[model samples]
Target: MIPWDLIKGGMRHHISEHMIICRPVSENTYFVLRLTLSYLSTQLTWEEM
Candidate 1:
């Protein structure tokens, strides 16, 4: 039989790894979107901003 702690630790490690892999791509897109929105807002009027 396997230890419960080992299973939990493995699952935790896997979730952290997935987050590490996915977080950067998401963050990059979010940052770019925010920048684009800010730029457009500056170029446009306050109503759209």
Candidate 2:
């Protein structure tokens, strides 16, 4: 299982960085972003464990 605290901090940093690079996202882009984030979170959690 992943630790909540670590995910929150790291996720925030990643999101901020992403926002800086891509400020305007369309519907398809949003869907892709969601999928990417989900994949990233799962990978990060696994790596943490």
Candidate 3:
């Protein structure tokens, strides 16, 4: 199984920005997407940032 720490770290650093931009599409989907994106962003790098 994937390590939770790694997964959470990735989302906070990488995917949060992407989800913030996607907010206008749909509220319900946006919420879910934001959660997933935020979760993935934490594991990204400066290049990804």
Candidate 4:
């Protein structure tokens, strides 16, 4: 969970680093990343908890 928060916070940094390295990424990979990030970004309300 700690690592996940770090990645979420440094999203732009990671994107820039990836671009600098010019690594090829698949669409499926990005989709999964966005999906997980979105899912994690939700705030849990007391009622939900």
Q: TM-score of model 2 relative to the true fold?
A: 0.46
State the C-alpha lDDT per candidate. Answer: 0.83, 0.84, 0.71, 0.70
Model 1 earns a TM-score of 0.46
- Which parts of model 4 have CA positions greater than 4 angstroms off? 1-25, 43-49
Order of all candidates by lDDT, from best down to worst? 2, 1, 3, 4
Error of 1 at 24 (Å): 0.5
Q: Name model 3 segments beyond 4 Å from true.
A: 1-25, 45-49
Where does candidate 1 clash, by residue pair? none
lDDT tens digits by residue: candidate 1, 1-49: 8799999999999876875687978867777899999988887886566
TM-score of each: 0.46, 0.46, 0.33, 0.36
Task: Report the lDDT tens digits of candidate 3 across residue range 3-38.
Answer: 999888998766666655755456558678878887
| Of 1 and 4, the candidate ranking higher by TM-score | 1
Which candidate, 1 or 2, would have the higher lDDT against the true structure? 2
Per residue, candidate 4 scores C-alpha lDDT tens digits across 1-49 of 3798788769978776775577546645776798887777654443377
Cα deviation of 25 in candidate 4 (Å)?
A: 7.0
Q: Write the per-residue lDDT of candidate 2 for residues 4-39, one digit (tens) a residue.
A: 999999998888777667774664578688999999
Error of 2 at 3 (Å): 33
In model 4, how large is the Cα lDDT of residue 40? 71
Error of 3 at 1 (Å): 52
